[model samples]
Target: RLGELASLSYGLAMTVVAMKTVTPEPAESGALVARLETLSNAIERLPRVIPPRGKGEASAAPPPCDLQDQIAALTSQMEDVVAGGPIERREKAPEQAEKGEVKKKKGGFFVSGAFSDPAYSRFALKGTAAVMISYLTYTLLDWPGIHTAMLTCFIVSLTTVGETVQKLFLRIAGCLVGALLGIVSIVFILPDTTSITSLVVLVGLVTLPAAWIAVGKPTVSYIGFQIAFALYLCILQGAEPGFDLVVARDRVIGILFGDLVVYLIFTRIFPVSTLTQLRLDLDKLIRQCRDVVKTKAAFDPAAGAIQEAGRAYATLETASANLAAYGYETFHSGNRRLRAQANKLAIKALRGFVNALAVVAAFPPPQGDAEKSEALRQLLLHAEMNLQTLAFSLAAPFDVSSGALVDSMPPALSPDDEPSPQISALEALMARLNNVKMTLFHYRRLLHTEAGAYE
Candidate 1:
């Protein structure tokens, strides 16, 4: 049920991001400090509910906080953690990454598409795959039956099981129900030229709404259309106006054959990690942190913005845990070394990005004397350029090992160089974004790694 929201609310959230409001103008420093103190004290007063320490550990009871209160606590904690004073911030050294290079920089449609989360790719694959299965099954059977191999495959892929099991379940449910509905359509509505055209139009109208309703809805609607199409084909062929059991059998056989293809391809050609996304998402977090750190050059980030970003990383960590589960599920024989390597680097990348971001932000350049990190001073321009590349989803040249790489990049995060109060409280937000990005890549790679599973 909730899965349906992936298409609906997910797109809506993206639309909201495209329409973000500009930061409000700042008042006096005294006013800002008062606000910062208020937020910090509020955060300090809130209840803390830490996660279970290890795998299989029972979760402790959640300490309830109102939305506002929770936001404050996370912000305050992120600042404290990143400040690395009383509590040392966790560190992930860089050399852990740098394994692979960009194989090729894509252009046009592929490049734009890559900037987005890849979960939707699976959905699109379902549709196209469904169409293929239907056409193939019918052709193999000499086109005797108006088969629904395509629609069945679409529905199956809509379900989670990665590919194969998802295909199996959805295909079964959709085809059976569709076939029954096709029978009803034949019983009630004629399939002459006019009627057929009307039926097609009706199918389109029905399916279009579900497309907006969400991804699965379209698949459901497609199944119904396939059912109509199948029975219509039989009727046009002048078959008797009753259920044809033989036709259904033909349909299933063809569908299974096609399903076999997808499954086999997945398990063979490339079996990838669904958790592969963490690397990219973590990469973004690092860039964002770098941006925050540079903010001090022009403007001191509202006292807690850096901390909030760190908190967001913690939330991302939680998502990473779930992603790790997928990692376990997707690993294959003979690929243990690659999987291990990927996971280790992934964790380091995740932590590194978050910590780096927070550190720069928390270490505010003194008022009226804004500079950059000593480790990165020479690389300021390069870092900014790299951040822009990451921000825009471009292929950036990564060579931070040079002795001249700077600690903080210049050019504040906000336009007109305004510091933000929310920056201090984004612990959950970072996690949420990182989680979404990570999950996306995880699905893509795992699907790739197990491409043969669809067969």
Candidate 2:
């Protein structure tokens, strides 16, 4: 049955592909194209034919001749092309080979120049220094109880100072909450518990809420695990029931100490600002949007233009998420509030721009209307140019005098124009083009605003 269905699907797809490829001249063979369409539809409605499984089983019925008819029609249409000449294969370009080599060289993690960047090196050294400080504090001071300090450093370390600080805060909050719960269990619950069953019940009670929290959202989930960890340490110190406040105290101190060390080292020495990273991301997104616009202008069905658009959308999503984390960052050099406001405005504009681009891409200009196609192409070109300018502006320092703001309006159609489907699509694209301009204008304006201007 599956085989029959697969064959039918393949036949239908091939029929459709052939229908799209063959452009029958209205004066010459329009009737032939109509017949092919009818046959393609008939092929889709054909019944599935299951083959005989054994010698006694009945044989499957033969398929209809619609497929053969469609193939014959396609071949007849292509007869002129077949008679013209044999097709020639083009050789690969040297530039393309060089590009492929460059892509291959930059593909892996270790070879991606990650260690070459000073910021990455600083981040690495900072984390290593934090762990070493914790390790030495516990070992040299002969404080085995606070050995979890080293573990805490490993758990909370992150790439950026803002991210690391954010994780450290979560770790601290989770640790404190967990420690409190552990202490409470030790005081009230442990005294009443006699058997291992009662102790298990107590631990389970504390663990239930912690597990609930741990499984929650990423921002607050660490609190839940910390709650479980703190409670477990205080309750399950040994095989026998033991209530020692000192163990909980030591673990909590170790976690807090590690956090403090990380915080001071990451923030005070060679700190990587999230806001700076956000700017770079915003720049990359603008360039991606430009590429998307450029791809949409040409609009190739088989050249993976859709994949490029998908990647741009993905970058937009990542930039938005980083903006959210940007709020938690306090280590930026400039007027952090002003930078945040500008970024927020720019991101909102970018969101609208991307959405408008999606609409424009969806309603491509009709292929038969050369004038409308050219007009749409012009609009996309204007948008692409403006996007390129915006990206350049974002890469450098913002300049009020820079002419980043350019007119992005599409050419207006005449009021007395005929009401054709192609014209309507063009009109829709024109409206979206106006929206794109508005967003670009807003983004350009935000970038132009100086720090003092905000004050």
Off by over 4 Å in 2: 1-102, 106-111, 114-116, 193-221, 240-242, 331-344, 363-365, 401-408, 418-455
What does candidate 1 score in Cα RMSD to the true structure?
A: 18.1
Give the TM-scores of the predictions, in the order they appear. Answer: 0.35, 0.66
Report the number of the highest-TM-score candidate: 2
lDDT of 1: 0.43
TM-score of predicted structure 2: 0.66
